[model samples]
Target chain A: MRFRGRALKAYVVASLAVLALHYIVPYTVLHRAEGFTLYAFWSILAAAWVVATVVFVSWGWLER
Target chain B: MVRTIAEFLATLVIYIAVGTAIALVSRRFGVKTSSEYFVAGYRLGGFLSSMTYAATTYSAFMMIGLVGFAYATGVGALGFELAYLLATLALLTVLAPRVWLMARERGWVSPTEMLSDLYGTNALGHLVAVLYLVALIPYISAQMIGVGSIFEGLGAGFGTGIAVAAALSLTWVVVAGVWSVASTDAYQGLWMITAALTYVLWVTLFLVPSAGLDIGRVAEAITKAGVSGLGGFWTPTTFTAFTVPWLFFAVTNPQVVQRVFMPANERSLKRLIQYFAIYAIIYTLIVTLVGLTARALTEVGVLGYISNRDLVTPTLLLAAHPALASFIYVSIVAAAISTSNSIVLSVTSSFVRDLYERRAREVRPRRSITLANSVVASLVATSAVVAFLRPGFVVEMSVLSSVILLPLAPVTIAGWVSEGVRGVARYSSLVAVVVGVSTALYSAAAYGPKKAFITTWFGVPISVWVLALSTLIVVAGLLLSRVKPHVGR
Candidate 1:
């Protein structure tokens, strides 16, 4: 954590790779979504968001 | 033309009244300095913050955009409403209060202030600010287009329509600036709520029931119109479509961040969060039911519709409550102005505060800078009219604006908490943004004119994809830094 500078550079590099993937992905791959999967994804994100909120709060108050 | 005239005049009277009342209230409060004008002098608390937050968050996008979206999509549209509810609450609990504390200490009037100060990298701050400027113009332009549409819908004279609306909007904005916007929001918020509820009730109760409209007819018509009519909400793969856009609407949205900052104290924020969630859910359900109802009415030949799918709600209400329709008619105007006023005001203020004042020496006064800011708003407004010549809907443009902001959110959140990633965190955020935007740009054109993207089980909008990739970028940076953490620092 103390030497986050190197870590940031690595992240910058990887993010660029993802951007490349975005471009490489074929348009034909995407299709009309079935609604259930979309709902399920939202359900999961809702859970993750709740968990993240808990983790974020605890991270601040516990050490303080 | 007659319709446009009526709509324009209707908008003018309601919007100017709302604006004047807000300005008058702010004037009476006697805010003596500029600090109070922008951030409510950093002393806003409880009721003022709560009401203003309600007004600020419920933009024209919500009243018109979501209604149109649901009219086209179905129950699946709930993904957006629910996502924003959860996201706003979570943001209020986490980032917002901290931003307040930090701003209280450091006096951050605009978001760019936080970006630069927290990262201690003014270049990164400026880069992000520049993106914000680019992204925000489209969003503001979306608001102006909304105003223009309301005029076109009502049949006002073109010259008077545009000039009157713009003039009234400008008058209220100058009268009290942010204070005026917030104050008018309080009043407009009330009218908009009352009118929305009234129309929802009347449309569902008398209009359809008397005509014997049913669900079967509604489904038949939607099936006939093709996939877009469903907006992919009913697709078996709807969940895939839901995840990214939902989250983006909630947590990653700048407008939501703006709401988090408006509340006066921790208590007010908590109350407002609870307040907004309940209100949002109730409104969503009511409006969706009405949409389904309208579908049946349209199918059964009970009501004749017009050019825009958006006019369904208004038309339904008019059919049901011909006597009381004027109330809701003006109420829709209230809804549009409530949103447009704040958006135009906030965007101009950001340009003024972040771009102009930030550059000015302390003694330069930036007198010309203030006028330049309004001129910039007008110029941007002109460009929106040019863009409108292309035939895209206001909601579509608004969604595009949201998609654009997705790339910037990750870097911002990372920088905000000082995420302890230091150099890696900042760099990752920046990288994520670049990657995200590029992905989105490529994806944007592919998604077609009406929709943005589609995936079967886990559709990620180009915007959401940007945020997700950005997050991955941050994580990878963090992990990589573990191996060699000495370079940037």
Candidate 2:
């Protein structure tokens, strides 16, 4: 249960990265992508989340 | 009308019978101690832990509220909900392991107890418990509202719906405590996912064809709706205001936070997060599509006008084939009862373990269980009454709950990473809770949901203001403190 310093550091970085992507992708890209089906747009957005999850999980595994 | 009512009743009966069976089977697992009763003795396997977490977290909001929101607001709704999911995953990655370790090592049953033990102050725990009850009661009530509105939309009386939801919620928790709640939650979780998939398929295969709605044409129409509704509803400020508090939901909300203590081991914890993330992604996508499809149908004149956003799903269901509608109806009921029972169990545990037990000495396990059962019953009854009053929209009620609970985020973060700032953190949390709750109440009262943010300072909503102010105060307290970190017990 000890808080591994490396894990905490990696988590912060991944969180910031994910959050920044979340903000940028929706506002910049998807918001302006006219005529894209909701499914198509959401699939891209879900991909962003998948990438974020991968980053988080990889870092967690490495730290562990 | 009679046939619809009969279908609804039959679905409800089947759901109750299944849930009761799960609870009865779970009860066979023995509950000799308060900890065992409240947390399944921390022995939940990965599947049970994951399903319970998913069920408790998803709630009726996904099918009913989120569908309505997406129908009304378009892709912005997806962004807001996705942001929550991402933030939750991030938080779980960093915090869950630490929380699990502390709980296992310290024998902490509630997050409040963990905070109190971390800060070496019982008052902090009491304050947290009180704030949790204040915030969560409305949220619990919102579930009842979800159920009531569904039934009302399907031609039954709202009062009957609320009563039925409350009775089912009370039955599961009162029967087997956390064991029952978790088992029933797992059962309900499966029901929810299956129902959601079926719904999406029905909408795509049957509804889309029947309506003659082209996906590309619907997308074009959505894009043409201009800034207010579909295309540009998520102005940055509005999005931040709505999403900031929810980003911390996994840690701040006691029901999910307490689940951090329930996994059997580290592997179980990891599996729980993995399972929840998959469930959340699939469910969010399905519900969002349901909303978009509903909107498209309305645009094509296939579905009638829906003036109230919350009625989007229910209205569609009412017009759907009876059997399909009945299954989805049962799923929504499962969502409501699963969430309500989990909240009841968690709140009851907080009352007994954090508040009552902290004050009294030498209370026996039997007495504690009896007291918890009484509290659960009372809380459910009170929340059902509140639901009968029908205070506000489900999503708005949930956001208000998150806003009031936002102050706990900084305290939790500081507790983990900081040293020797216990007094500062404690007092800052108290101040923040007071100010945040007051501001939220005043805003809600003065303007209601639509205009609630009209009176914002510097163009930011009161929720963001509360979060910023609370974090600032906590930072200031940390800067002022000079004491060394207290060694862990």
Candidate 3:
């Protein structure tokens, strides 16, 4: 089966959470940080997104 | 580091010759049908699929536009570009499988055909095909302009640059259609990434330390420049305006959406997304660092402050090894040609499959392929002329095209997610596009494209408004039409 029921909800919630952190952290947490810190934070986020995507697809959550 | 025009032409000629040979050789693997010509008969493996997708998506915008943006905006440019990467990965993971399955089952050639099939209307396809022409021609012309700028920098006339770019784009597509384009795109994509790696290494290993600075000092310089954090032009509103349209690029952009139909199977499609995610992140960081590095150099008094952000990369090139710089320059040309040719091929698909085929009853496979080639040639020529003219609004029009295409997001999402987009929902797709495009055009005319893009409605950028309004229209149509919930593709 595809991402249905609990799996569907999980995917949506996780995506929304990551997205929220992406937007909110820049202003709330890193507002006064040096340029390098901010850059590292984003780089970490990018890496995490790549890992998550590979994991999700591997789990067959993205397929029908 | 100053190179003669003859030297520049020699590098470009060798690059073009190698690229042309790759494209020409690809014809042996080509099929004869229009579907084969346009989409490689939906048989691209993971490497070619991912490479073409990367090359087509990243354009001259990366090394030139984004580098400059990063120079001016600091870490915000990284955030903005990463937002796009993140969103694209999420969207592709969800939508690509469905689109690929459906296209394979139904033999859909054009992206418009898929939408038209889902919504049960040729009208939508025709309208979208026309919209593609209007929006993408300027974008294609912009790529040519990028090439012209690089050649002009090399002391070759801008006109010579544009003519060469136009000629290459036209020839590649005509040689074996998408087979040739994809083959050459894979080659160019390698060139692009290699150039990027060389550039980043040159900056970090040599340029920074030669200026009596290390990573720590560079960070200090950027921090002191006041571009390290979110303020100034990186204001929330401005970022929102800049990012919203780009976030939906996977769906709204025809060239990329068509790529969803190219990968040979489920595995290839998945690989395309995964590989592209890796490429996108790497390229994004490289360009962002290039910009920030330039800014850091300036702050430490090693280089002059470049007010025109676009010129930052060129200025930095002056200090680099001459051979390395010229390779990067050719890579920029490769980037432009790869992107422009893909656009030409895709727009031709829409023009032929959606518009022309509707009128010409029983267009034989050979005839349709011939017609497609003609359209590709015409598009290249027209874009070349537009690039030569160097219209003032070309850049604005290119940016505005994304905003104009915002309505496609809702229309496409609705078609894929719902069981059937029927009744008023079909009309809703049409209405949404018209309303969304008209609003964007009106704002561009009233406030000018640049200002209008950033113009906020209640602290929300106009781009967000365009998306919200388009979504609202689609939702209303769904409710009124009572489309059944989607079970699965």
Candidate with top lDDT is 3
lDDT of 1 by residue, B142-246 (tens): 555665665555554333434544555565566665666667767777777776787776765666567774444445544444321324355534433443554
Per-residue lDDT over B396-439 for candidate 2, one digit per residue giving the tens place of the 0 to 100 score: 65557887788778777767655545556667656765676677
Most DockQ-accurate candidate: 3
DockQ of each: 0.07, 0.41, 0.58
For model 3, name the residue pairs that clash: none
In order, the candidates keep a fraction of the true contacts of 0.06, 0.36, 0.51
Candidate closer to the true structure by DockQ (higher is better), 2 or 3: 3
Model 3 has an lDDT value of 0.88
Writing each residue's lDDT as its tens digit, candidate 3 over B1-489 gives 346455667778889999999988998986688889988999999999999999999999899989999999888999999999888888888778777877888888888888899899889888888888888899999999999999888778799899999999999899999999999999999999999999999999999999999999999999999888887878888888988999899999999999989998777887898888888888999999989988999999999989888788899988876778888888999999999999999989988887766567787888888999899989999999999999988878987989989889989978888886789999999989898988888898999887888898788889998899989998999999999756344
TM-scores for every predicted model: 0.76, 0.92, 0.97
Error of 2 at B480 (Å): 2.3
For the predicted complex of model 1, DockQ is: 0.07
Q: How close is candidate 1 to the true structure, as a TM-score?
A: 0.76
Docking tier of model 2: it is acceptable
For each candidate in the order shown, give its overall lDDT on alpha carbons.
0.54, 0.78, 0.88
Q: Point out where model 2 deviates above 4 Å.
A: A1-8, A37-42, A51-59, A62-64, B226-232, B391-398, B419-423, B453-455, B482-489
Sequence-dependent TM-score of model 2: 0.92
Q: What is the lDDT of residue B208 in candidate 1?
A: 53
What TM-score does the A-chain of candidate 1 achieve?
0.42
